[model samples]
Target: MKTIAIYGDSISTGTHGEGGYEAMLKSSLSLERVYNFAVGSSGLTRKTPVGMLEVLDKNPVPKDAELFLIWHGSNDWYWGSGMEEFSHGVKEAVDRLRAAAPTAELVWVTPIYRFECPDGMAQAGEAYELPNKNGYTMLDYYEELEHSSKRLGFPLIDMRRLCGIHRDNANLYLEDRVHPNRAGYQRIGAVLDREIQRFCIY
Candidate 1:
């Protein structure tokens, strides 16, 4: 079986339900070697330095693994990290993955739009001039990750565009407005499966 290592936060990890992209990918592809290495509230620049180190050391992807899917930045952006640090941390993670699995194909996933809520609105209200302290916009992180992937030669599947289709008319996301529900995750998995097939033979 072709192995796949998926690294990301709660969205990809399926913390809310057993319905994230990782689970869907396995079911769609009928592959059993897929590893879900995502953690809730995990940021590329984590509070604990050893957090990433521990993950890397424990689940180093083998050289022959078919692919590595990286779905990061939601938590980092949510934690109020700037572009520079976010970009750097993503690069570091990619670099470390390459070092661990030199021959593996790498697929990067960008963060999507988050819904605005009263609590977030209230946070922005503290500043008076600025509103929506959550700063959850589709435009914020897409281009950043796109350009970075171009520079680094990694294939990226833009989650914004995929999620955008249902974003306007439907509640694709859960109550938190961050994590996607089962239907949302299935949509995401379908997109990734198509893109990865085109990019990789497996």
Candidate 2:
């Protein structure tokens, strides 16, 4: 029985009765223990010093963890964080995780597609531009995460591409255009189970 630690935002925390992807993965893999260090509305970078990295530093994961899964960046993009800050925060978080769990296999999961709604669109208006204009879209974050994963020697799971959430399938998977619904969580869990099996040969 292997121990897995999940670190991320709302997607990993889940909403209401869904229990998120972590719970689903636990059941699917039949693991002995699963630790969730995810928080709602959290991101890699923040204006103040209370972000994911800070949280992780304050409350480190168990050293017995065999796998460390990180899924972040959506809130960072929504909050207009710069790419450099995002990258730095990720590096810090990864370093902390590695130091805490030296033998753990690290995996980074990219952000998924978020649907644009009328309220958010109205807030943005016609002239409102993206926060990180250079790396605006979720895909840009995904690319950056992929690059970081390669540089840090961590395997990456491209959730955006693997989940296939788009304009057409937004209603089917997403609950509020940003977070996944129960069905969506199930789909993501299935894919993650397969990926974990392929990556870890326990």
Best by lDDT: 2
- Candidates in order have lDDT scores of 0.65, 0.74
Tens digits of lDDT, candidate 2, 15-97: 63377787778888888898888878787776423568767767857899899888887767666567787778778888888
Alpha-carbon TM-score of each model against the true structure: 0.79, 0.87
Highest-TM-score candidate: 2
User: lDDT (0-100) at residue 80 of candidate 1?
Assistant: 50
Reference-based lDDT, residue 137, model 2: 54
Between which residue pairs do clashes occur in model 1? none
lDDT of 1 by residue, 1-202 (tens): 3688877777776666466677678877777787777777775665423234347766665666678888876555455555676667668878888887787889888776565432334432111122224553335556678878888889888876765534454465553556677766767778887888878765
Clashes of 1: 0
